[model samples]
Target: MLIRDLPEDVVMEILSRLPVESLMRFKCVNKAWYFLIRNPDFIAKHLFWATSEKRHRGLLLNREHEITRTPWVSLHSNETLEVSRYVDLLQFFPRDVGELVVFGPCNGILCLFGVPADRNGPRDGLVLWNPATRESKALPIIQRPAEMPTTFPFRFGFGLDPKTGDLKVIRILNLNFRRCQVEVYNLSTDSWRVINTSVNPIYRINSPRFPSYLNGVHYWLACERGGPDHWLMLSFDMSNEVFQEIALPSLTERPSFEAVAVINDSVALILAYNDLATRFYYICVMNESGEEKTWTLMFTIGPLLHFTRLIELRDDGFVLLRNKNGWLVLYDPITQEQRELPIYGDSFQVVSYTETLVMLNGSGECA
Candidate 1:
């Protein structure tokens, strides 16, 4: 029977199961389909299916170009590193938009901040991109929070507000060693607002852990001030717009973290410490509900692999690492195998990426 002859409910089910590229083309199939594809409810439904565990997974690998050295990120198969979609990030913006700071893929929407190469040419800007649909929206700039006097660069954290289903990005400005100015941008309203809070002592979510936005919260592993350097996780709840401090396991009062990642929707830290001149990686998961947070040591990784740098720890049994040759490698914990990628760059930026129908509202520039 023709797709039109199928019941609308059955049709929705079939369309939702199809990949995002297929769904985008179906919008041109018929008026009924075009409306169905654009429906917010249907978009959310499609996202839910796309993120399922049984579905085939991909990686969003961000690295500098091997030859020209221009920064670019691409979508590739998790196992083979076979690129399916290549995104030349700067190509989407005006010539002066410049190099970009990559943020989250929170529900498939990875936000980018264009750091203008020529200040006199174009202003520094922000772009919301869904690599799956190749749709991008240029966000209007608002008055940013005042800069912190500290020489360290400020940061932006992105996440989906669980309570409202709204996408939000937070700009954190460290005011001192003590206070931080937080500014939030809401995607639905396309507006920015500064948050008022008594959140104290300026716990920072550093760059090494910038990808830690999981389960509606943004997290960073931070070191306490003074003394011998203690450890804590600073988390910002997107829905509540509040910050919380989570203590780590007391292992000589320090845990050497390689990276922070989300596994099965829970935040996990990859710890690399030396054991009798042999370096190893440890996975620790947190229990967030109790009065005191607990960290459970999940497992240990090693036989001293030739990996020179630890890039990222993916949720599934894969670890993205780099070697002395400056190439990326995917390590599977289950198979105890390693596969090297073709690209060559020193920048270690790779994230486990899943396709989604989010931000395909047809209101943005077709990427």
Candidate 2:
């Protein structure tokens, strides 16, 4: 009647339901259990259960120390929003302020890099990390391909390659010539290669902080180059590495700010307009199941009620908001309850993550 005596499928079902920390320790119990836990199919199933059940969900927070200015990355429980673990990003990069960890949670893999101490310093090495298993793979610094110098920070996104199921890091540099020079780092090959730039859309990937990668595609609120002042959702399919653009809802006047995020496994467009009275957020979710993509307006959160901006959206109807005077708040519309989060620091970075053994020992096929 022991777990080991159970049928293979039954054991897997029971083990998959357990938390990642327990499964990690269970791996050494026996050779058969070790192999079973490491199997790609088993890992994917466990990840599916974790995500669907919302059991191992955590929020990654990137912030700097208020007194020392030291950069730190921590994982907090999604339910409690309390810090569970801390990894100083300074250890990953030599620079003072490491880049925000917003690039991922793609199959529990994150792209980590350094922000130059100033605008002129060189970037440090890039690393792919899985906080769940505490394993990381560091890549060589990608050298700038363009001969012309530019001051813009290299925009990077991390996602799963749908075809190969391998992890990939996308580095995009919008050159002055209105073209994007793209390089992709494939984790399976552990190398970086430049993809063709001729076919890339001329739209500039809008923001560095809030770009979202859901499933096998990366989403960004982009601006078309040399065209009308229309906003577009620029998406790159990781499987084919093809660029596609989805137009946003045309407005009589441009929004003061635009951002994109993945909510409920769909891309959401957020347009914020500041008027004389207060700021308003136009929230829309894009539906792609049809022959052509369509946008649906979801909500219009507004009137600047204490919270100045929307930071995170949860499936359970909780909205994370931020104050203009430095406070993190959460709003539950159903209960009409508002509470401030204990987390603090400047330039806060938050991403939802479901713990998985994807990058255990920094090698495996990601889910």
Query: Which predicted model would earn the best lDDT?
Result: 2
**Clash count for each candidate, listed in order shown:** 0, 0
Model 1: CA > 4 A from native = 53-56, 66-69, 95-99, 118-123, 142-151, 176-178, 201-204, 208-210, 253-255, 275-278, 305-307, 360-367
lDDT of 1 at 214: 84
lDDT of 1 by residue, 283-325 (tens): 8998866577888988777644444667776666677777678
Task: Give the alpha-carbon lDDT of every model.
Answer: 0.72, 0.74
Give lDDT tens digits, candidate 2, residues 73-113: 78888788888988766566656663455577787677777
Residue 112 of model 2 has an lDDT of 73
lDDT of 1: 0.72
Q: Which pairs of residues have clashing backbones in candidate 2?
A: none
